[model samples]
Target chain A: MDLIRKTNTSYLIFLAFLMPIMIGADYFLIQYLFNSEVEETLLHEEERIQYHLAKDGDLPISNYLHEVTPIDKGFELNPKFKDTLFFEAYTDKNIPYRLYSFSSSIDQKPVKITLRHMLPEIEELIWFFFIATFAILLLLVIGLYLIHQEIYRSTWHPFFKNLSMLKQYDFSKMESTQLNSSGIREFEEINQVIITLMEQVRKDFQNLKEFNENISHEIQTPLAIIRNKVVHLLESKNLNKNELRQVESIYQETNKLSKIGKALTLISRIENQEFKRLDRVDVSTLVENILNNMEEIINFKNLDISTELQPMTIECDHILADILFTNLINNAIQHNKEGGWIKIRLSTDTFEITNCGDVSEVKPDKLFDRFQKGSSSKDSLGLGLAINQKICEIYEFTLNYESKEEIHTFSLRFKA
Target chain B: MKVLVIEDNLELLQDIKSFLEEEGNICEIAPTYKSAMGKIGFFPYDILVVDITLPDGNGLDIIREVKKENIDIGIIIISAKNSVGDKIHGLEIGADDYLTKPFYLAELNARIKALYRRKAYQGSREIYFNEIKIKPDSYEIFINDKPMNLTKKEFDIIHFFVVNKHRLLTKEAIAEHLWGDHIEMADSYKFIYTHLANLRKKIGELGGKNYIQSIYSVGYKFTDQEWT
Candidate 1:
């Protein structure tokens, strides 16, 4: 599946087919050359026999010739060439030979002379060449494969290293990755492009963060001035009843505006990932402390509060953790019915808070959305649960809300 | 008491100066950090109310400079940026208290008074309003030299009234002073009235004079003199 193995397999298949064909070609070529050499020796033997016959005026006996048959009629005009088997007296076995027969005149009568050459020596020479060629081809293939593996590993090392660096890069930290220069031109180009892109993204992110902070600060200053001016105006001793009522409404609206402004800033800050300080916060103790802080509100509503806590710790921003639990507990207290019971359970990996309240009129899907208020409380800014959800998202925790049978439950699960 | 208010906003600064002046304190204003530095270098005041962000410079630097010149001057940082980082940083640089913006003027007054008292007395300070006396450190109150039983919230309300005696206190300011930021989520300020009524009843049961007077539909005013 990887590049090196895929190429090696294809090369091996090609070699598997080519090896046998190369050996067969060598075999045929060697055989043809050996046959020509045998033919030359046969011609020499025939000439020597002819010379002896002419000198002695009779055929001479020799080990090369086993038999000489005399024909009753004249021989044919052309020579006949064929392969035949002859028996050897010493070994008592049939040996293969290349036999050539021709017609010649002996004592003015036509007779045929044949010469034979045994082929066992040429067969052994062909076998030796075939095996040697195969061994050489095998060695060449193995050497090429090893060289290719080494080249592949060294060439692709920088690419894989860059890939891991990209994986570990975090935008929140705003730290640039230091890329090593690969001598390869293409890899260097790719690394340069990525570095430029990341720098641009970080610049854009910083600009957006500054914009949010500026807007929040700019808006809050004027709002503060307006609220303070109204308070100062209300201190006048000559204002009538209607004037007092109007000023009171103005003061209350300013307060509400201030609250909404702060909440919006907090939500944006969470979304921007500004809270980077993380610690191992004890979630159980945090919940207990929040519940105790909300004791007055709970008592005012005459709600019976109970908690089951198992010590649990999670890594999160400490201030955000405080806000998370405060919002959850406040939501529970604000919505609970008079004389209702509130139950909280904390475990190693999960924390759940449930309270008895009137059937919620807010849609289940929109419960954690900003400005989504319940029908009962109009004064609520409705950003509490939304902020809590944002914090959970930042920390990679799961926040869920469910309402059934007049009981509303909020649960958070920490990633293990 | 002589106080210096360093704020960039002209209108808010004027209001704070006039309000504190009406409360029988000498008040001065510096609308920028450079002017504030000039004023603190030349003038010695009981307290310095500083805004963390100023038009010319940072209020934190002003705090550091003032602390170096005079360690006895109390510093309260006011900022529209309600971040915990700024608050902690300001306190670390010798600020005695931190108040986020859009805060009530009454709340500001109470913090200024408390800071001044802490600086002047060091410890073992008691506030007296006619026959009502409060020991803030011990969380004990005595009416006509007899111990009075009160809850934490009740005691805080009484202490706040005694510090800002004869000054009109709004329900919103009282709620903020008692509950801090949590007061924003309340559907009504009616709980504050309940706490005040209970405090009044307890004081009357202890044979103490009634000093808390309602200012019609506005709020309440705690003064020894009766006003119609």
Candidate 2:
């Protein structure tokens, strides 16, 4: 879960528990205070009755608040506070009261006097307080929740905005990832760190690309000089048959070195996104041209060529398309066996090629790596499929390779 | 043919000057951009061979300077950078041809001769080698005034052979020449053998001597001498 959601959910759970607990604690305290205050009011009523008997020398009539009882001579009665129920004639209901009673001689006769005060209906009061507490807690919980949600959103807004910026950062465009100051110290510091880190990454990537170009040139020049010198040596009259063969071997290696350097540089260029020119290239025509160019080579192995093309076009760097198709078709022909039959089908959405070649031992996942070859051949540079894969990735085309027994197939599906 | 080679590498310059000079062309060398400019300012030449990377400045700048002279010169740019952008830019700026580095000297010689033929104001468009008349433009060949039938590749092999006559042409160079730089033709040694055999047979049937010789199974040599 995200930070805001997680924090909000936990806070809601705590409030759910706190609301009931706070209300219960307030109920018990109010009930206890009401009982003690009622007992004190009953005692004050008893004191006023005693004062009237002593001062006025007269007794008040019996009622619900004062209950009078005649007693025998020398009656021993407990005079203290007690709880009792009294019936009212007018109301005709028994009501609970706090009572204070004592056996005292009134009007020179033995009599028992009791003072009562109606206790408040605690159930009704409790019900009222319950509803009141419920309303107050409900309001507080809702108010606090909304205020917390507002704070959460405002505080995390810039963080998420810059988080997306980090996700969308592009090294090829050379755009700076300068995060805005969000007025939050931790977030601002993290943004600064990310910007610094991205700048460093861009610098390293640029330096590596430059290094690739420089190395290719640095190696190509000497290779050229060596190749030219070998050409001169091959023309020498003093060289015999073996010398000429050795010199030719040296010459071929030099050519391969030159090609490897160039191929590596091309890969680097693609990764550096240097080829930006986009043109609408006809896939059908491009495939036709490469196959036609390789007709002689195809014939060398006595391979059959069958093609069915429907006009298909794509927008990409035309050179990359040419290279992609050339490499794919060339791989089909190069790895093909004698008397092999090749089949090619192209449509507006998909292109597929199948050829029967030697059973490949190269792993499927390793097929598109540079220098990974199905067969060990000194003449093959083994960079064809890798370059094709790179081009396909750039165009968002899906390239699939499958081989069963000696039949290998490659299919490319273009993005719609 | 008069040619001026502008390159910073002294050894490569010497190599090119000697190869073209041996081919009966008057060749001059300039080792740096300043020297190249100084030479081209005073003298006029039929061709200028330039390397793009120079010690002082880019060789492309020299081509620009020579184009300013308007001397009817054929310029071939040589560079170690095998970039499509560089190639298109070079051609756009008046370069007659673009040759990437680490090239066979024989290939260089063939291109230089082809450029010379293309630049000549009044000359035979056909190259002659001992009655083997090659029309480079139409990809046709004639022996004893008889038009010979040849495939496009066969015609190219003959054309390449005639241009770099009496020289050792490796199988690698011929494959690279037949198939322009990109196609992986490493196993094309068999293709070259088949084509060369058919080419030699066609010429032999036309009453022309077989002048192409195999050198120790590594390369081929074309000469004026008759094969036994």
True contacts kept of each: 0.40, 0.54
Residue lDDT tens for model 2, B1-228: 989999888888888998899899999999889998999998889899998888889888888887787778999988887777888899998998999876778888988888888878343588889879988878889987788997677788888998988887988889889877665765688889988898788888999988889866668888886432
Q: What is the C-alpha lDDT of each candidate?
A: 0.81, 0.83
* Docking quality class, candidate 1: acceptable
Candidate 1, residues A1-416, lDDT tens digits: the string is: 98888999998999889878988888887788777887777777778778877787677775466356566674464765577787889989878888776666578666778878887654676678778987898898888888897877888888888888888776755567788787999989988999899899878877776786677667877887887777666766778889988988897788778888788788777876778888899988898877665565666678898899999799998989988888888788878787899999998999999999889888988988988988778778888888888899888899998989799999999887
For each candidate, what TM-score against the reference? 0.69, 0.83
Q: Pairs clashing in candidate 2?
A: none
lDDT of 1 by residue, B16-39 (tens): 898899888999999998899888
Q: What are the clashing pairs of model 1?
A: none
lDDT of 2 by residue, A18-77 (tens): 867866787788767876786667666667767888888677453435778989888798
User: What's the lDDT for residue B74 in model 2?
Assistant: 91
